[model samples]
Target: MLSPRESATRERVSLDGLWRFALDPEGRGRSERWWTDELPGDVEVPVPASFNAVLPGRESHDHIGDVWYQRVVRVPRGWDGERIVLRLDAATHRAVVWVSDTQVAEHEGGYTPFEADISEQVRAGEPVRVTVVVNTELHWDSIPPGFVQELEDGRLLQQYFQDFFNYAGLNRSVWLYVTPRTHVDDVTVATTGIDGDTGTIDYRVAVAGDGGHPVRVVVRDAGGAEVARADGAEGTVRIEGVQPWRPGAGYLYTLEVAVLGADGEVVDVYPQPFGVRTVAVDGTRFLINGEPFYFTGFGKHEDFPVHGRGFDPAAMVHDFHLLRWIGANSFRTSHYPYDEAFLDYADRHGVVVMDETAAVGLNLDTGAGVLNQAGPMETYSDSTIDARTQETHRQAIRELIARDKNHPCVVLWSIANEPDTVSPAARPYFEPLVAETRRLDPTRPVAFANFLKATPDLDVISDLFDVLLLNRYYGWYVQTGDLVAAERLLEGELREWAERGKPIVMTEYGADTQPGLHSMLREPWSEEFQIDLLAMYHRVFDRIDAVVGEHIWNFADFATRAGISRVDGNKKGIFTRDRRPKSSAQALRQRWHGTEEPQPDTTRNVQQDPQQDLQGDVPQGVQQPARQA
Candidate 1:
């Protein structure tokens, strides 16, 4: 793993542009020996994007086999004698890389960055051919797992157990970086504690090529003033008068880890920005730096049109702006880990993130495959929690923790989203994963998104977490449009969770609101209904002090497989897929952003009209009812 950016000591060249692409659906590319050179059909496609959504034809959009990408990169002359590495930011599912005739690297996970050492493979100032084979197919062992259904007509359909489109490609950037022989391999920084005027930071560094190399660590405050310095790989640095990072006041300290070679020259440097804050679970409260903290945001997806889950900075910026506009302060990367720069922005902007793994919908055959599954899916088969999938999930979590442990924005580590938690088999599957996370990093709280179901006897895995994340859909999916009963059921469940003596966060709660659709009768799929339902859930959330946060089901509408239940994808987003505000945004602004407290009748069935009372701010596309026509 490397820093998100490059410096003089650790230099990198971006290989993010058009690349030669070829589809190998027949899986003959390996047998035909396409690894040595380019494949036959010559089609140039953009790097940092999924070939699925950019190309024409339904075949390319749903191609689910070995896809090849070829690009020629020139080794920089300045990188001579240095440890040259080729890094793929992200490739879906699995990827194998070959530098010309030499097979360099193979990585299994898709959401994290992986690199291959190519120091001896290429000559300085010469061009080298790089080939990447990405497998987009899914199986029982895959996280956010899915299966392909062979129809009776010989037509294959990709059906994901998860609710998002299966966007596959080198959907993130590629880079060729150069570092000294003995580099700063790994950096782990943990916030120990914060007393009145001093804050403690515990940090460690792993040098790559050589051991016993002198390591130096330095920390600079937000104003670029050096506050503390320390030596040794594992030691603590105490900064006097340290400022704690809080919501809307994201104070970050830059920690630089540097290694020195035998010549006493700086070989490599890794800079990481961290916040000085501690998170702990006490009694029934989730505390951030020793005070009760509440999380109010959305369970978001890195999805949109054209790019199809590809990393788009402009879109991400717009989404963050809209989130701030809607009075949201946090979000959970539901189902998968997002790009690195996303968390960097979250750290800068003070948005707390429940950093979740890509291990979603692991419960096979059951409708739990779908988010907020819309049926009776009580029977949790053993196949869902098999040994192979468990091991894969464990690896994903380790990589996630190792990658994101430094971010102050990440206050909670969510192991999975909407998994089969109610089954008897889930206990053995989830217990070890949560235990391992706590073992790996005890700084943050560990929790998983739990679906509302199963009896107390069947659902027995709630004790493993530092907090409780309940994904209940009382108004939207339970009663199908009734917020009143949804309120009662939501309250009762919150009561049960409060009895556990742990903080409860409503991780998933929202209604589907079509962007242009509006209704006066408060019907389903209307913006008003979305606002009404959220208001009800927020009422119960405010009443119960044990409830610490409420992350709405989604921040924006995202692409999903074509199904009867999903209307052009799940419409539960408070904002449209294009980042336009729904009525819920205006309502949430009043409830969260405008005032410290919003006064409303939580027990009332009908909500107040936004046209008159919402401080002259009307919901997007809301229409005033006609006067007696």
Candidate 2:
């Protein structure tokens, strides 16, 4: 959705290194055409990784189905009347591209960015080739829906849909760019309305040919002057004393849309980088520009330790410098949608995101331990591929609210993660995915991610979210360590989600520590039972108050898929997975940035030093509770 930039005086071309990979697993590269040339025994491989964890065996990263990359390019001469494209920054569950054999484009949701234009199959001076052909395979109408098995000496494995580690190849980065054939295309921006000291913003552009020019938006502020300026293409700019983009205190504003012409010059700009601010929610508080914002970090995972989910910009600025050294602010890409340089470093280092959507494993009659309140409850799948998986989950929630409704650290949009909202077939698949996400971007707040079988007398879909992202696990997966029965089942599920008045975000509570696991009394995969399950889910999110926020289910520790309840992965990561830390990251830097907490080890024995129980991190015939704490 309009996010393949490079027009600051256009002209791109950085097809990011190696190519010519292979695989096809007998799909035989479009039945032996292989994009009409080259790629016979393919090899090189590396444009943005995951080629099965940067190769080292298994025919270069466990062969799935349909693969084959290629590459050759050339064109550049004078681009021959403009408009090139080919972008591709990711190519997971499906792609098609081809240039020499002509195909054009075929994409089908693979984490985002996709383009093709290629101006009538290139050849301005030679080489061309291209070819792509991905296809990591997913099913029941895919949107994260997966499960491909097949063994018996034939090998094909992939089981399990969500919880990370599927890492297919061509994970990101691949350009060619060069626009201007009557360019501009799209550029939303929203903030609209701030008051007290003036704010607004609004703007919207989308030029691509059709009667020449007249766009012009421009707003600049982080010191490059320009203040406010508008000419058409869509109004409102406002400005005044408005700096607001605060979380850890951060600000940014510098639009510059343009299109001008008719002798006004600047024929195609499109700079976009907004952040005027406004995240509203009101009822049970979660405002932003209106204040009340509380959402301490993690539900994350684009995962790493070998570029599994690829795109590591120095591990994305060290996970936003360890979520501002554990004081946290917000995070929740969990279940999908990440990388656009991690929302441009949460729009210049402020934080707060949410933005989900790989609509995770949409239930489908649950399998294995799938939300087993002892199974037989699993629902969601009304057939016809669940109506083509709810139309690819409403086109991945309108492409994650059109590629993250103009950032300001994307407040919230979620969609589905931990779905099967306690079936009646999940209210016709989440009532049209919450009416196609409030008809795509009703400006922030649209939540989802509520597992723990959405209780409260068997869920009513958390009264259709505006916020109530509960992914509860009570002392870890249902009273596993039994902190007084996980605080009376989280005070009866936070008083039934604070009596449904909204705002409740405890999106996934943690408990999976293995980094130097220890236990004198604190058991379950101890790093002291993941620091006593985040100080008992932060003392029940500080005694309700509509339980505002918590996050913690992962800030680090990723790479899941060696089973036996994940040992080499999904160690609920409060760091470790190479990001280190994990003594519950020093008890969340002492319950979020107040620091100095780690003490209790005065030679062990809080109740007879014996490694309490729940040996392999309970959850599945759940037992282990020698009762200690």
RMSD of each: 6.8, 21.5
Model 1 RMSD to the real structure?
6.8
Could you give candidate 2's per-residue lDDT for residues 1-629 as a string of tens digits? 66666656577777877888877777867877878888887478677877888777776466677888888878778777777888786688788888887888887877887787878778556778788888887766778876566767977776554666778767888888777788788888888778987898777888887575888877888887888898888888899987877776558987888787888988778678878888889998888787777777788787676668878688878777767766676788888787787887778767778888888767644543542122232345443237787888788788777777888888888888877676666776687788778876777778888778767678766676688887888877776887888888887778876887878878888888888869899889879888877887677677777777778888888886666777677788888877878777766755555536545677777578444311111111011112222
* TM-score for candidate 2, residues paired by index: 0.37
Model number with the top lDDT = 1
lDDT of 2 at 5: 60
C-alpha TM-scores of all predictions: 0.91, 0.37
Clashing pairs counted in every model: 0, 0
> The CA-based lDDT of model 2 is what?
0.75
In candidate 1, stretches whose alpha carbon ends up further than 4 angstroms from where it belongs are 365-384, 454-457, 596-629
The TM-score leader among the candidates is 1
Candidate 2 at residue 184, lDDT? 84
